[model samples]
Target: MARRRWWELPPAVRGAVEERTGPVRCAEPVATGAVSELVAVLHTATGAHFCKGIRSSNPLAWMHRNEARLNPYLPGVAPRLRWVVERGGWLLLGFERVAGRHPDLAPGSADLARVAGVLSGLASAPAPAVDVRPAAVRWAGWVDPEVVDGDTLAHTDVTARNFLVHAAGVAVVDWSAPCRGAAWIDTALMVVRLVRAGHSPERAEAWTGSVSAWASAPAGALDAFAVARAGLLRERHRGSGAPHLGELADAAEAWMWHRLPL
Candidate 1:
């Protein structure tokens, strides 16, 4: 998607946002995220709000709505969704601007400890009764569909980019594709991301020591999931040809091989 500045939006769309926020004072574009036609922090009479918007007719538009619907279920773990506005063929979302920086996931970074604590909190949360896709369905082709079932809501995409390390703790963002699955699944997913960030597979798995769900997870299920995740990453990389996806796919395969018996 082409980058869109706040002023570039149609007046009707800007007016819709102003209705909730009063006059907009300034807008600072956020450059980190891959999605969103427009990602900016809007300063207004209401203070600062992180706003993301996309054309309403886009195929990925449902992701915006999914994030809005799931935000209520995630109180402290994520930024609160303040408002949603649809006008001039665009859908805009406003979120409370959390003051923080992206976490460092390297082995000795202090931020890693905070990330572990936050991931543990998420693992313990029961799945919200919402219309979300199940992990079993998402991994059906690559693993035994039944192996991924559980009552916990898993933030399957636990990359370093998705977490904000603040004074209070860590906040996970981007709830667009969360799924219902085993409580240990997120810690498992993070393991690959950690490996991608320079942790050896052994140390990455060791970091999950504080996440109780990881300790109790069935060894067979963990093995199955690693293989399935690696397979999926490989397929996605082949299709997208994104360098980062290829790197991540290699990391996932390395983690999967590390789990196998010699």
Candidate 2:
């Protein structure tokens, strides 16, 4: 979807936001992320905060609500939600701005360890009693529903863009797809991303050594997830014809093959 600038927001929507955030001195539009109609850093006299929103008519608009609802439960690993704005057919969420860059997931980057630490921390996050679907149900046809079942909260989208590396630590963003799943699900998802970042499948799996959830996850369950993830990515690539999706699909395929018995 095409991104809308902060100024493009309806006057009513902007007014509703300023009512909470005060007048915006400047707005820096965010260029990353595939979703969201309007995403920008609104700078006010007090401070700058991140705001992302979509028109209520969009089918995925519920994602904004979920992110707002889930942010409270994810303190250290995710940004804090400051306020919400709903006006003129748009629902916007304002978040405490996180100053960070996308993590470098390559073989030797120091950021790798930081990424591992954040994911490991997230592994123990108690599942919030929200309306999120179970991971098994979300991946039902692609993965063995039983293997992905667990009680911890999982940020299903573990892409590099969803993670921000900063002075404090790695903060995971984009909670639109949170789910109830196995504790190691995020780490398992990251393995495919590790391969996409230039690590061979063997080295990528090895990188998980520091993540306790990955170490304790049932091998059979991990294997099931790998295969299903590869298949799912392939289908997505075929449907969207997006180059990055194809690259990730290839990475997932390599990981799936590596997890297969010798």
Candidate 3:
């Protein structure tokens, strides 16, 4: 089946949700990735809600299901899940919109600290045994093996864009890549992305330390995981037209070659 636009949800589904939540005032494309489409805000009588659209063709349905199942267990990590709708070949999940901007827009020691804390909290939560091997295969071209194995619950994609800063606190979103692995995997991914975005090494290191302290992970593993993750990012984005890919690849290569020697 062809992909449907976010505005093209079945009338029945829209009606069903509206009856409970009120009308959807507006929806804007918030984030788009290889597996799923994310919408910023779907206004209802209660308030604005974030909607994540998952394509049936994508194999990350398990991840979404895991997210729905694990949401209750994770505190202050993600927005509250309002509803999950499966229509035709697509799945639409509605969540309370986390009020805040991406962390990149507002960088600070406090913001970084909050992000680290959230990530750690997520890693520490109990989750069912999930087969992360397939994820390793799918993301193998994009991430290092060292960061993709073991029993730790790792949020593989931990870029600044995944965080939402609100008046109350920060909330992390996008669980499509949740995998069982070492905690450092998530930290490594975040540190690499931050460095690629031009954050100083010291700041990135500090953020990594904060995340480790919050998550209770070993500090020595941070540098190795970061190097491996940087390489993975470089390999994945090497030929992409996205301007940031080149910079990220360069930073990853430098960090891997010089600092981590990986």
Candidate 4:
């Protein structure tokens, strides 16, 4: 589970990126994420650009590529993709740097409203014509047996780490997990994170209702998502040693508790 640092990247990979952005004045390795092999910012004459990649042999390399392909369709939600390079057995992707901080999802944080507003816009974004897994297929074992479906492109990973609060607006970064599903799926995903960050089930559900798709979603589908997410999180908590996993599993359970009938 060790991560590759900025200096550890192949000279060819760095050179390939430099071809687009000029010399890397400084390369800062970002230590926040878990999945990707590399995540960092390259300081250049123009400005800082975020970059990340994984080894070609790794099966998840396709995920890095998928983000590059999904960038244009992401519209204003994500930072613009600058360039992508496949070199030295790695897939490198560069994105325009946005000056911002992660939004606070804690109780009473003003950002709750802004983040909901952003999710509402997603109702208007249909899945682009690309070969991507549908949410039902993607979340198969964990979601309802009914295969909850939709045409809107959903940013399945709605964790706080991905929402960048900028002077421009909240830019939802990290499109690594794009799924075609009910537009409301996004609102539900965000509500999970909201509950993780300490929102009560009532408050979290209230925030989700602000989004049209969520407001109109069939009660059965939402109930199914609740149970399925709790089941998935419980399964994850059992396998992982991370302390936070238990807390997250508990949060998902809280949401499930709100949905299930006596």
Candidate 5:
């Protein structure tokens, strides 16, 4: 399928969308993953809302729906699910846009702790009977026992770009990669991403440890899973054509091998 340009959206469709969503002043595409397109829409009355467009045939539609269903349950952890429109084999989900700096650009121990607490709450929540897969399972042999057994809800994509620090608190966005697994899996991904971005190894470790401590599991096991899962994620993203991803993955792999003991 040819990549659909944001400007190419039909006036009728755009108008209908705006009417349903409120008054959209500006719409700009925000690139994140390969399967879906995210548009950050600035509404004159509603402020900002993110419109996530997904193909009807995409296997991850279940994940998106699950996220929508789970958002209300997680009051402050995620953006509010505003509206969902299905048209022409596409699912456009509108979410309240989180306003603030990306966690990576403005790293702080307080922010990390707040995010950790939010994740922990989500993980401790009762698991849904959704068919979402475990992220650790995707990497096969690199799987960590803690992640495999915890079976908590995991936001597989916990990168800084996915986290939005707002006045209400930090809200995590982009739920297309939600997983039904351990909270440690999410923590590991976040720590690894931060470490890859030049955060001190000691700081990353400490943050991970603190998050794990809040989780209902042994810290050592969670740490092990975080290390191994970080390695696997880095290895997979290392081949990505995106220069930043490749660079981050390479750095994460090095940190996994050097800073983390086998």
Candidate 6:
């Protein structure tokens, strides 16, 4: 999908944002990600802050509110939300513009260590006592329901692009798919992407083992997760050229092949 630029927003919406931030001098849109209709760095005389928004009418509009709600409780490693504003049928959020590059989760990359550190911190985060559906309920059709309950807040969409490796540490961004479930769930999600990035299933599992939640996960649960991921990946084959769709499909097959009972 084509990304909308700063100029694309209605004048009323831009004016509303300018009311809080000073006259916008620069609104450079980030050149990646399909989730946001408008995502850019708004530069003022003082400094720059990250901004991303979607129409209030869009189905994913609630994610903006969800991110705002979760930001206070999210681990310190993730960028914090600065403000949330709604105007002219759009919901926008300003974030603590973290400086970083996308993490390289390839098998031999130096950034793998940093990725592990981020996952470890995130594993221990307790879900704020809010009402978000559990992972089991969210992926109920593809996974065993019994193995999905937990209290840890999960960043279930831990694709490689979601993590930014910076000087301070690895920072997670894009809180679009926040879920409350087993902490291992995020690690499991990441493992698939790792495999797609050329890590063997054995190697990916070894990397995941560094995270306590992944190490403590039940064997039965992991088995079910492998099968579930395979099934879900197949279901997501939209026949469109989405990012990493084919590689993930292959990873899914590899995971299921390795974990399925012989």
Per-prediction TM-score to the true structure, in the order listed = 0.97, 0.97, 0.76, 0.94, 0.76, 0.94
Per-residue lDDT tens digits of candidate 1, residues 1-262? 7989999999999998999999999999998777799999999975999999999999999989898888898747789999999999999999998889999888799988898999888888898887778988878779897788998998888888889988887888888889998999999999999999999999999999999899999999999999998999999999999999999999999999999846
Q: Please give, for residues 1-262, the per-residue lDDT of candidate 6 as tens digits.
A: 4567888899999998888787889998797667788889999887788999888998877778888877887778778887788999989899888888998888799998888878888888788787776888888888877777888888887877788888888888987667788878888888888889899888988887678888789989988888888877776765665657767988978977777747
Which residue window of length 10 is worst by lDDT in model 2?
68-77
Per-residue alpha-carbon lDDT of candidate 3 for residues 123-212, written as tens digits (9 for 90 to 100): 666444544434356456555555355566666776677788888877888766566666456666676676776676556656666554
Residue 30 in candidate 6, Cα distance off native in Å: 0.3
Across 1-262, the per-residue lDDT of candidate 2 in tens digits comes to: 9888888888988999999999999999998877799889999999999988899899999888878877877647788999998889999999999999998899999999999999888997778876778998899888777899998999989988999988877888999988998999999889989999999999999999999888889999988888999999999999999999999999999998998956
What's the lDDT for residue 137 in model 6? Answer: 87
Residue lDDT tens for model 5, 1-262: 2455545655655665777767666676665545564355545575777777766677767666766666665535777888777665666778877667676423564676777766666666654665656655654577553445655667777777777777877777777656666555666666667776667656766665556434456656655665665665566675556776676666566556555567
Roughly what TM-score does model 6 have, to 2 decimal places?
A: 0.94
lDDT of each: 0.90, 0.90, 0.64, 0.84, 0.64, 0.83
Per-residue alpha-carbon lDDT of candidate 4 for residues 1-262, written as tens digits (9 for 90 to 100): 4689878888888888899999999988887676788889999999999988889889878788888888987868789998998999988889998778889999899998889888899766888888768888988877763546888888888888888888878898889888888878888877788898988999989877678788788888988888888888788888985777778778888998898846
* Clashing pairs for predicted structure model 5, backbone only: 152-181
Cα RMSD for predicted model 6: 1.6
Listed per candidate, the RMSD to the true structure in angstroms reads 1.0, 1.1, 4.1, 1.5, 3.7, 1.6
Off by over 4 Å in 3: 1-6, 28-35, 57-66, 105-110, 123-150, 213-224, 239-241
lDDT of 2 at 73: 75
